[model samples]
Target: MIKVEEAIAIIEANSTKMPVELISVHKALGYVLAEKVFSPINMPPFRQSAMDGYAFIHSIKHQYDVVGISQAGDHSNIKLKPNEAIRIFTGAFVPDAADTVVMQEHVMANKDSILIATMPPKLSNVRPKGEQIGKDEVVFEAGTLITPAAIGFLASLGITEIEVYKKPKVAVLVTGNELVKPGKNLKKGKIFESNSVMLEAALQTIGIKKTKVYRVKDNLKATKQALKSILKKFDIVLISGGISVGDYDFVKEALLQNNVKELFYKINQKPGKPMFFGSKNETLVFALPGNPASSLTNFYIYVSPAVKNKMGFSEIHKPKVVRKLNAAITNNTGKTLFLKARYDETNVTVLNGQSSAMLNTFAIANSLLIVPQDVEEYKKNQLVTLLPID
Candidate 1:
């Protein structure tokens, strides 16, 4: 058995980054960059007008002649003389001779002539060339996550595609013979299979989409064969059952038979004490307990970070905070206790139906109240740390 923090550290040290691929920026959101991106051209490549105004050479005179008009996406290079101005719209290229812009609201216009009611500072409302970023400058460094705003900035720089770290290929191997697929008639002592779908959905939330699912019998031969095939192809493999030392449990033996080095077999935690972690070559494997709630709990607290780190994410852990407990609680299991709870800004309330096999209370929970192994009792309004799941 091991501590939860120790298990997380082991997984982190064993994880490695995946290979890189060149993908279109349109599809690069949530992906980490593999190479630094430099601006191909100066953003706002020309001196531009920041608003719909009159571009003119600065003068003490309160009147000017409008020589030409410049709308957005057009360059009216009409040179302005003293007291001469051009009608310029937002994002339009400003004439070279103009040194200032007077907003239309401050100007009284008569035909092509205008009277300036106010004098703005020189170069006011005129954006300088390369004001945003200069050409050949670093726009984003390696390891930056491509967010939607980053996409817009890249589009402004004319970046159609970028090199990014590839998402790891994952496989979910559910090991049990009595598991039945949904919509099937349930026989005596048989249960519906749900861990595969739940685990897959959990992976999708972290931007891992290339996942495959498989089922293996509870026997040793079937488990070994399944492990061998998945271990050979996937970067990360999640096995859903048979990790404990029950009569039909065979995941541990199968992993050893396939030459997988065990990193840790169990954690001193309630809900998921039978968890197993191992490695075969460059691939990482996690065997979560078959119970529904325990499987999901182990995935969030342990497997999610490993997968995120493999895809090049630096900050991958769930958000943790201290909140006052709404009710008193006691931990008598002599191990760490994980409970589903609801939390606001400063308080958390534990929900009912916390059994490992149940998921009803989990559906409404936004956080997990974690009680450490040594702490036996907690009074109402006592501060406890919680990991948010929503």
Candidate 2:
């Protein structure tokens, strides 16, 4: 078995970013940027009004004649004289020679002339050209995760479309003959299939929107056929169960028979020691443990980062926090362990029953306590690393 960090490094070194494609700014949300986006023109593009007011030269303080009215989209250029002002609405272009704007609330307006009750300062309520962004400025760097705010920023720069990395296709295979679909009557030794649904949701949350879930029985022929068929369709394949050395486990045998290159079989970790990863014809596959908590933990630690890296994200790790332990805990000395934990501002407390198959403790866990392989016990108030869910 290899260390978790070594396994993570192996997975990351082999992963490559996907090809880039042009997508509409509206559709680019949650996608990773493929290229650096530079501003072709200034953000405002021209001097514009920032408020509904009168645009005039600050030198002419008290009295001014209303020369023209400027509304949004009025391209007619009107230059202002020393004693002249333009009745401009918000977002309208500011006329030349007009360096100040007195809001209508402060200016007493008549039919043709306005009285300036408050002398506005220069450039007040006026958006100068290129004030927000300049031409050729780097608006967004490559490998950025485009969010709604980013989309708005790009739109402000008149970018209707942008290049972004394509979302990776994922195939989730839940293997177990004893597993039945939800809402079905459970027989003597059958349980409802929950891993598929859980993993599918988890993948979607990380921006891998294209996913397909399949149910495979524990037969050699069926498993082999399914693997062969899916290998050609998906960029990443996730197999739940059939990885441990059980009598019905056939995934390892099928993978080896199909000439799949095994990268690593297992890692020195608790709750997910039977995890396996390999590649077949450029398609990556992960065989996670059957237990629900173990499968999810392994997915977050290994598979999720691989997918994120392939999608062109620079950072693939989740947010972690440092907290002091509230109680003492002990574990095996040789294997790293991720125990379900609940943490707040003051302390982080481990949940009871660190078994891989248990779900009750995982339900209320907001974080995971990462215990390295060399440590056997932790005393109270010991500082530890906590991987937060969000």
Candidate 3:
């Protein structure tokens, strides 16, 4: 067995990054950039009016002759002379000679001229060219996550395709003959298998769309055959159950029969002590414990980071913060325990139903309270480390 930190370090050292590919910017959400992206042209492209009013050269004169109107998308050569102004709407290109724009509410209309009720400062309502982004400027650097705002900014520059790291292809294998699909009649000795569906949803939330699922009986031959097929097809393989040293647990033997080199067998942690990690060539494998809560916990703490790293992300783990505990609790386990918790800005409530098999508490938890391996008891309002779950 190894400490949890050592296990994470091993995974960090062994994780592989995916190859970069050009994809449509519209479909690049949540992907990390492979190269720096620069703007081809100025964001505004021209000095534009910021308000619906008059465009004029800044001067002390309160009145001027109305020359012509300039609306958006009009390229008419409308230039302003001294004591002359043009009726311009918002977003209309300001004349080259115009230095200021006054709002319509501040100007009084006359027969052939307009009276300035109040004059604003020079360039008060003008949007300068390239105010947002200049031509050939670096807008986003490599490894930046593409977001909705990024899409809009890229579209403004007419960028249709962008280079980004591809999402990993994943495969999930559930090993247990006693497990049956949900919505089916429960037999006397069988329970509904839920780890596959749960893991699938979890992966989808992280932007991994290519996933394949396989079910194997508790026999070594069946497990070995499924592992072989999945290993060839996916970059990441997640096996739930049959990792412990029970009589029926054949996952360890099955992995060894294949080419998977075991990195670690167990970790010094509660709920998921029998977790396993290995790799065959470039593919990463995580064989989590059989319990529902335990498997899910391990996925968040371990597998998610490896996946994020493979997808070229700099930050792979969940965000951690220190918060005060809302209540006191006693932990007799001699291992590091992650308790399901709900937290606000300053405090966290350690929820009930923390058993390895229970998912009820996990459903309501937004955070995990980390209790160190050596500590046994905690008092109310004591500060503890918390890991926020996405």
Candidate 4:
């Protein structure tokens, strides 16, 4: 057994970053960049019109002879003498001979010429080349999370591929024979199994969609076989239940038989004190308690961060905030308590039902208030650490 901080430090030390691969930028959304990317070409490679109007040389006379027209994607370089205007639309390339554009709404058109109705200066409504980003400039740094806008930006630059960190392969194992699948008829001493689907959804929320779930009986042979097989294939393995010491508990013994190195067996904390963490080569394993609240709590506190860290994210932990308590509380259990709570901008209210077996309070709670092992009492309005789970 060890402290919570000690367990977290061990996990971080053992976390391995996934390898980088060059993939199509079209498929790179929700992935992290492994290398710094530079802009391949200047944005708006030519002088672009910023409005639907007329392009012309600025004249104090406020009138000009209408020349040939130019719309978007028209590349003909129409020569313009002094005071000659070209009918132009938004996003069209501005002719080099013209230096300014006037919005069509402000100008009156005659048969073959137009009178500028608005007093505008030179170079108005014209987007100069390279105004957004210059060629060979730093566009994104390593570890940037790719988003939809990023893909469009790269595509506009004519870049088809990008270097990004590969996503992790995960496997979830649920162990227990007494568990029953949901929607089945209720039987004697049987509970509906939910941790498998619950964990799968949680994994999806963190951008990890490649995962497999397995259910194992409470026997040593099946436990050993499952552990031995998944440890060879997956980057991260999460097991729910069958970790505590009981007559049928075989996970600890089976893990030893499979030669998985034990990094930490337990943590001196509330709800999830029986949680287990281990590793085999590059494969990391986490065995959480059977209770719903405890399992999800451990997942958010430990597994999620470790998985995101392996995906090349620097900030992996859940967001922590400090707020004053809405109600007074006292704790003298001499163990760290992860209490479910709801917090507004300035104050947090601790919810009822802190049992590890029930998730009634956790469902309505948006944050977890960590009561340090050393701190005993918190008067109303005193500051405390609040970790938002949503």
Highest-scoring model, lDDT: 1
Residue-wise C-alpha lDDT for candidate 4, range 1-390, written one tens digit per residue: 788899889999998889999999999988888999999899989999999999998878788899788899998589998978999999999999889999999999986999888957899999999998899998889888888999999899888999988988999999999999899987998899999888888888878876898889999999999988988889999998999999888888888899888999989888799988998888898989999999999998899889888888767886799999999888888888899999998999999999999888999999989998888899999999988995
Better of 2 and 3 by TM-score: 3
Candidate 1, superposed: residue stretches over 4 Å from native:
58-62, 103-107, 116-123
- Locate the minimum summed-lDDT window of 10 residues in model 3: 202-211
Predicted structure 2, TM vs. truth: 0.94
lDDT of 1 by residue, 336-386 (tens): 888999999889999999999999999999988999999999999999999
TM-score of each: 0.92, 0.94, 0.95, 0.95
Candidate 3 per-residue lDDT over residues 1-390, each given as its tens digit: 988889999999999799999999999998999899999999799999999999999999999999889999986587678899999999999999999999999999875788899999999899999999999999899878888999998998999999999888899999998999999999999999999999998887777866898999999999999999899988999999999999999999999999899999999998789998999998999998989999999988899889999888877876799998889978897888989999998889989899999999999999888887888999999999988886
For candidate 1, what is the TM-score? 0.92
In model 2, the runs with Cα more than 4 Å from the true position are none
Q: Which digits, one per residue and each the tens of the lDDT, describe model 2 over residues 1-390?
A: 899999999899877788899999999988999999999999799899999999999974698899899999996488778899989999998887888899999988898999999887778998989998899999999999999999898988889999999988899988999999999999999998899888988898889776899888999899998988888898899999999999999998888887888999989999899988998766888999999999988988898899999899988998789999999878765899999999999799999977898878887898889999999998999999988873
Q: What is the lDDT of residue 94 in candidate 4?
A: 94
Error of 2 at 285 (Å): 0.6
Q: Model 4 — which ten-residue stretch has the worst lDDT?
A: 310-319
lDDT of 4: 0.90
Alpha-carbon local distance difference test for all models: 0.92, 0.89, 0.91, 0.90
